[model samples]
Target chain A: MNVQDIQRILRADLLCGEEHLGREVQTACGSDMMSDVLAYVKEQSVLLTGLVNPQVIRTAEMMDMVCIVFVRGKRPNEDMIELAKERSIVVMSTKFRMFTACGLLYEGGLKGGCKV
Target chain B: MHYVVPPDDFTRAGEASSAVKKTLKQIGMNPDVIRRVAIAMYEGEINMVIHAHGGEITVDVAPDRVDMVLADEGPGIADIERAMQAGYSTAPEEVRNLGFGAGMGLPNMKKYTDEMTVESTLGVGTTVRMSVFNHAG
Candidate 1:
């Protein structure tokens, strides 16, 4: 699915990368731990996480992820948002908790990127 | 390229890796190779901040391979074999609260890079060397 589908499914507010809402993403994974997120390699992927830090943005950037959705209504700081903006990764915040948000996205046809 | 990773600056930890990624992209390297190098180097960068008291990273890009060397003057790894395991981390609780310290750092670095080695000394420092091949055979 594309970034718009994820936004609509999760009822998320776009924090940055407004121009990239149409960007295509093949898969997604949700995790609070950046270490787990870094272990997988996905192309054109979306990252869903509750963690709010500069490392989240850096992790997405390194993995070439197209978007990051902050779960549990957690919003990142200006520095993190600015970093995501600079890297062109779409950033969004959703009120739904992690499980619900991920389930909704999965039900909306977004599949997990992990092989195991 | 050479970079001095500032000590304990978690926010700026991945700058070196990010810059190297941009350079590889601009030079028109293959996307897969670039991603491997970026991810491996990024993991190393994070490890330096979370464990070491900052470090130095040097990257050499060539037609066939890209080599990354990270050196940190921190308490060296106590056991290289155990550290290589996927779920063994010595990072403190504060680091884990920051969404890291899950113990996959070293493994992820190894997973992404084609070649990797670790050299460490007690009360001295640690150095990690990794290589990613530009071309797949």
Candidate 2:
């Protein structure tokens, strides 16, 4: 699915990178820990995270992820949004909690995307 | 390339890695190799910001290998083995609350790179060296 599909599935609001909404996201990983995400993720395109900080966007960029879904109604600061825009990563804010948001995405055909 | 990581600036932690990644991409480096370097360097960078009082990361890029050295002047690691273990962290509660300090930083660095070594002096400082080599795609 694409970022738009994920937005629809989880009721997310697009905060930036609107032009790239059609970007394809075959797999995703959810984590509040950036280190775990960096260690385990491979070829994933979307990141669902609860921690709101510049490092979140930086983690996604390091992993080459194209989108970030902020769970638990957490919103990124202006610096994060600016960084995401610079990195061409789509940023969204969702009201669902981490588990619920992940479940919805999984039910909507998004796999965990980890081979392990 | 040499990068000086700012002290305690969580917001600017990954700028060096990002710059290197962009350069590697522009030069047509292997995607796997580029990502490995990026992740390893990023983890080291974060460690410097969180544990060390900022540091310098120097990267040497060659046709077949990417080498990086992260040096920091902060309270050095008391136990290298313990620090390498997953989920073993010395970071404060606040750092953990920021979604880091999971004790996976060094381990993850080792996991992604081809070679890694840590040299630290207690109460003095620490330095990390890691390399990533391109395997035939």
Candidate 3:
């Protein structure tokens, strides 16, 4: 699915990178721990996380992730948004909790994309 | 390229890795190779900020490989074997609160690089050297 589909499915608000809404993402990973995300994620284009920090954007960039979905309505600060903007990474916020957000995305056919 | 990591500055930790990624992109390196270098170096950068109070990172990018050397003066790891375990972490709760310190830093660095070596002197310092080879060329 595309970022647009994820936004609609999760009732999310686009924070930035609106131009990327049409971009396709086949997989996603959900985690609050950046280390776990870094260690296990493989080719996932979307990250559903509750953590709000600049490192989130950095982690996404390092992994070449195209977008980050902040679960539980946790909004990022200006620094995070600015960093994401520089990297052209889509940032969104959703009211759904972590589990539900991952569930909705998975139910919508987004695999975990873990390389276990 | 050389970067000095300011002590405990979590927000600025990834700057070096990001710069390296941009440089690699400008040079038309393979996306996979660039991602590996970025992830490995970024993980080391975060480790420096979290545990070492700060450190120095030197990067050397060549046509066939990208090499990174991270050195820091901190309370060196007492047990390298245990520290490499997936869930073992010495980072305090505050660091964990920031969404890191999951004990995956070194392991992830090792996983993404073609070569990795760690040298630590207790109460002195630790140095991690890693290299990722360009396979797309």
Candidate 4:
């Protein structure tokens, strides 16, 4: 699905990378742990997490992830947003909790990649 | 290009990774090798900040191989065996808040590199050496 689909499905606010809303993402991973996101995540383009910090942006940068949706209405501070903006990674915030967000996206045909 | 890791600052965590990525791009390395080196070195950078106060990173570039050495004087790893486990972490809550602390740092380092080694001395320091060989397939 596209970033727009994810935004519409999750009712998320695009905090950055508005022009990238149409990018295609094949898989998704939900976690607040950066280490888990780094280790187990493979071919997953979207990261759903409640964690907010500079490292989140760094993790996405390292993973080559295209989008990050902050679950639970959590908004990242200026530094994080700036970092994401610099990397051109779409940043979104949704009111849906983690489970609901993952389920909704899963129902929308976004699958999770290999779990290592 | 070589750079010093300043442990007192959290904002500078990925400086080494960034530099390496830039160098890989400049040197025309394959994307896969670049990504591997970036991810592995980035993991090591985070480990340096969260565990050691700061550390030093040396990158030796070659036509077919990239060698990285990250040395830190922070508290040494007590157990290499357990630390290599996929789900063991001793990171504090604050570090966790920053999106790390899930215990996959070392493992990810291994996963993204061709060869990796860890040498540590309690209270003295720890050094992690990793290398990724370019595959021209």
Model 2 lDDT per residue over B1-137, tens place: 99999999988899999999999999999999999999999999999999887999999999899999999998999999999999999999999888899989999999998999999999889999999998854
- Checking candidate 2 for backbone clashes, the offending pairs are none
Angstrom error at residue B26, model 3: 0.6
Give the runs in model 4 whose Cα sits over 4 Å from its true position.
none
Candidate ranking (DockQ, best to worst): 1, 3, 2, 4
Write model 1 residue lDDT over B5-114, tens digit each, in one string: 99989989899999999999998888899999999999899899888889999999987899999999999999999999999999999999998899999999999988
Could you give the TM-score of chain B for each candidate, in order?
A: 0.97, 0.97, 0.97, 0.96
Model 3 C-alpha lDDT per residue in residues A1-116, reported as the tens digit of each score: 99999999999999999999999999999999988889875798999999989999999999889999999999999889999999999999999999999999999999998765
Q: B101 in model 1: Cα distance from truth in Å?
A: 0.8
For candidate 4, lDDT tens digit of each residue in A1-116? 99999999999999999989899999999998888888864677999999877878888888889999999999998888988998889999999999999999999999998754
Where model 1 places Cα greater than 4 Å from the true spot, the runs are none
> What local distance difference test score does each model get?
0.92, 0.92, 0.92, 0.89
Candidate 4 clashing pairs, residues 3+ apart or interchain: A34-B99, B7-B53, B7-B54
lDDT by residue (tens digit), candidate 4, B65-131: 9999999999999998899988798988888777787888999999989999999999999999999
Off by over 4 Å in 3: none
The candidate 1 chain A region of ten consecutive residues with least summed lDDT is A35-44
Which window of ten consecutive residues has the lowest lDDT sum in model 3 chain B? B80-89
**What are the DockQ scores of the candidates, in order?**
0.94, 0.88, 0.92, 0.71
**TM-scores for the candidates:** 0.98, 0.97, 0.97, 0.94
